[model samples]
Target chain A: MAESSRADNRVLLLKLGVIACVMFAFAWALIPLYRVICEVTGINQLVKADAPAPAVAASDLAVTAAPVRLRFDATVQAGLPWQVRPLVGQMAAPRGEFVRVDYEITNASNREVTGQAVPRYLPAAAGNYVKKLECFCFRQQVFKPGETRRFPVVFVIDRAMPADIGEITLAYSVFDVPGQGAS
Target chain B: MAISTTAGHAPHEHGKPTGLWRWLAATNHKDIGSMYLWFSFTMFLSGGVMALCIRAELFQPGLQFFQPELFNQLTTLHGLVMVFGAIMPAFTGLANWLLPLMIGAPDMAFARMNNWSFWLLPPAALLLLISFFVPGGAAAAGWTLYAPLATQMGMGMDLTIFAIHILGVSSIMGSINIIVTILNLRAPGMTMMKMPMFAWASLITAYLIIAVMPVLAGVVTMVLTDRHFGTHFFNAAGGGDPVMYQHIFWFFGHPEVYIMALPAFGIVSHIIPTFSRKPLFGYTSMVYATSSIAVLSFMVWAHHMFTTGMPATAQLFFMYATMLIAVPTGVKVFNWIGTMWQGAMSFETPMLFAVGFVCLFTVGGLSGVTLSVAAVDIQLQDTYYVVAHFHYVLVAGALFSLFAAIYYWFPKMTGKMYSEPLGKFHFWWSMIWFNVTFFPMHFLGLAGMPRRIPDYALQFTDFNRIASIGAFCFGLGQLIFLYNMLRSIRHGQAAPHKPWEGAETLEWQIPTPAPYHSFVEAPHVEAGDNGVIHSMTGGAHH
Candidate 1:
């Protein structure tokens, strides 16, 4: 019985040894298989994500041949507590070139109260080019019993825009401009 | 092993379960075991029907047949049915049948809890199924039930949450029973090490369910409060961060993954050596690895949320923790193949599935590492890649292990052998069609197709069509398996003692039609060279 038991132990040990070797091979094989799978599955697809380009920007063609000629789509509201960002929607540019924003603001308040409306461009980077558009930050508006106001400014750009870049963005804020008492 | 009954319970013979009352009032382990199995099989088919509905819907795009609301409902129901209905119940069923037999015990320590545990599921599933007809339709928020979205859903979501709570309670009760039984009910000769791999696995998995099922319960509870009771636990407007919800969910969720997988680990451990006709290799190492994987499971919860924009330090910690799981998991795979190496081998259907499990589970594991990388996961987090990875783990790993287990033990249960040729055909069909259905999903996901979308860009139309076809074939093939199991049980040729030609387990060595009671005289213990009972023999089983 002892001899038979000793032989069984030997067999068990040998089996264990062989088993270890097989495991090593399986693990090794998995490394490359994993690599191939990762590559196939686009494991690196979102590493450096690029934001999508906009569909079509009218500002894209605000070229060096013209001033920053921007057309604003305006809606006038009577007694609705708001007015358009650009009334005449007049934007000055060097004919066909890209520069900065130019626009007119109208306050439709009945009382001698002061407030300001912020402007935003369709493409984001248009705000990056400055000095052409007069901002609400410049001065306080006081409508002395129905004030019809027009604000304007002038500036240009360094003329550096990507050819495929067909969009520019401008964003602004609207608030009761400082030093003008509306409350 | 070396445990006293933490709770007071008598070892009672308990009368034989007879008539309908027996089933209703049944606390005996055997009756409960049979009930769990039958219930799971019923659920398996029911879930299978939902899968077919999903396949039929996706058979053609452009809303050919089913409307989008119905399509979303089908998908939601499919997820709930498969997760709660089919897979979890299947594992619990195996636990019921095998726990007593493997442990050399008369029955589970708390048999009443086992019965109560199973009874909860039918009612809960009924509620979930019944939600379909109740006014606003089923929960289409998907299984994760991401908040604000889930909060805003209709009555179906409410029913689904209630159903989830019931399922959670059942799982916890069932787990507590297994833990108590494994600890207290082993025969006198058995030690902890003498326990089968399955017992150790179920022990760990039981602990997982007990710990995390409560967390899932807590999570859904919070969801309910957020939705109806004006709680701001997940509302960002009320000083609550939405991302915190993901943290809690995955905390429960990651361990829930292990709760499913560790049993598969145990099943694979059991089947690998049987077919190889060899003693299990690295038995102690296997134990340690299982424990390690369980421990690692808690820390890796955040790996799922890598794309949710956590701090760099937090992301790094989670990423590394997740990767370390691969080491222990790797050890398990090594141990399995190691058990089979240079041994005499035969290709029974059980063995075939076991071998397939090794290869395919590795495919699942290797993909797991890709998701573990903080940088790489940014792209893959909620895509079809995540979907495919889990199915590979759950389906190929757990479900295939389930198949191998069914094939392995059908004889012991039925007293007859299933046709081997037919079994092999089912295996190959499942294997081929499973790959076809899940593999293309990776490419589609990589090609930027997001998951949970009802419609997709025209570019993805072809792969979806092919996948739909694969899904149908796969669902249809399961019929072959069900038919084979039933036919074999009723009228197939008789199975002898130890039907697997070279299987060495005590379960196989027992008589065909394994009697209502087994080894009732005295325990027969087998000792290895190290004077350890490799597995305890259940002599006092009756």
Candidate 2:
């Protein structure tokens, strides 16, 4: 009886050990699995930047609509040592027409530095409707000491955006990249 | 061979090791258990000191006592130490001391592993506390260790990670030892259905630990790689969403809360019936309810992240699943009240704490239900309300039950009786002050005070001051408990085998202070008419 009970104990312990291993694997798998769930269900509005932009609705773009106010904001993280601001603070553009804005950035420090800009849409849900064609945020920007450059963003406010959101604000915050040198 | 031969002549006389070396190399369950209990108390005091420092800083608001960084460190370490070092180890210690005695077994199945599991805790605790003295101080990303922030922290984060890994290893080993011992070592005819509620709760808790500790190990590894290696698991610039980190974390984190609570449920379950002079009202339902709570725990991890912007459908599903937990939990509460109704009840220190747990834990649970509504949770997620809800659950639920266990089993473990007047004073003082400290935080949270900030707006000053005063009184009340326990151990009157007359468990049937080897000859158990196990030979003493 003792022998059999010991055997039962060994088998049960091994089973539990196996379950622990499987659960660990499942935890790791949850990463890609969450992406798939998001894709299938459209749960998180995590618009994949790489996906081919849905063929712009030619009919929607042609509609003559009222001009909407588009505003630009720029801020640099404290440690970046850069002076950055939108060259044009605001613009009025007809809905569905493409528009472009420029932000001027200068490396204020003595040494050349590299920085990246993170973009945010004011109402957050407006992220999916705003498409970026060319933006400084796509890659790192290098600036020589005291050198100034014009960074541009080209986008269209999809007529698909709700009419109630009459105005949209696009903001950028820049952070320093530690390892990469100035290009 | 020589020791076995001498045991034949004098069966009760076994070779006993003495002094410091004995403790260092001990494999005996009782000695290791005593070490675990003492170690847990020491950590509890350390964590309590950190809690008081946090209260002092918030006493008048405006960062009067500490810089924000130091305050964050105090709050972070206070949480980590209380959960990992104090509460979890206390439950493990109680299991080690009582499980074998309750089951009529000689000792734990893996005695050496038990010692290793216990010894692992002190070094891990040292790594956490010692980080406070390091260059950048400790990890201040809150105990949640949300990513991107955790990735940017200094060396203190690595120390915390290693500390967590070591703590996880200790819990896993301790849990496995519990699972094996309970499954294999119960005396014959005791059967799976017949084991005590504490052992059953320990068994389920062991399974939960095995399931989730590895997940904790996995998530921390991801954080490590993100810091050192070129990985962007949490960095959005590198194509990783920070919310993914919350997903993996709450998977382990939610069940971890129940891992702290289920054992408290088991402890309170025994205390209520024992003091009420009645057989437990629904022993089978209690076991089933505990198992249900564990099963439901896994389904509700996402409730913590409702405000993190999950899809509406995901939020609704998680909200409903979290609300369903109140059902099984309600059943357990009703059963406790049923046990006390019409039974000649006595109010001892343990009974008082047990009653306190039932009432306070219900308050915590109801607030939990309110928070489960995703709409309401959006407002309360990171507020002082969240802080108030968990303290009610943890300090009142887990900590209150721990005090009750100590009072209930103190005589049996130490062969001494504590001062009843001091014990009652300790219980009442802690209960009143505990409510005073946390109750105001609910109002503070609803009035728009966010947690984790060292300073608050001038409008929030009054309640913060009230909370700080209550916290000091609550901290000092524990010192009285410390005095009572120490005074009892050294100078109080000797205890009888069964100090509580209404007790019916196997532990009460044994000799006082329990023998070096409990049940050298396994006791025979048959189910009595009450559906409670009574040993034929063991009950002869009655």
Clashes of each: 23, 0
- Model 1 C-alpha lDDT per residue in residues B164-265, reported as the tens digit of each score: 989987887777777766765655565678677888899888877776777677778878877777565676534444666776777778988888899888
Query: What is the lDDT for B12 in model 1?
Result: 34
What DockQ score does model 2 reach against the true complex?
Answer: 0.31
Interface RMSD for model 2 amounts to 5.9
Per-residue lDDT of B397 in model 2: 99
Q: Which stretches of candidate 2 lie over 4 Å from their true place?
A: A1-7, A41-183, B1-14, B528-531, B538-542
Q: What is the C-alpha lDDT of each candidate?
A: 0.71, 0.85
Q: What is the lDDT of candidate 1?
A: 0.71
Candidate 2, residue B236: the lDDT equals: 73
Tell me the docking grade of candidate 2.
acceptable
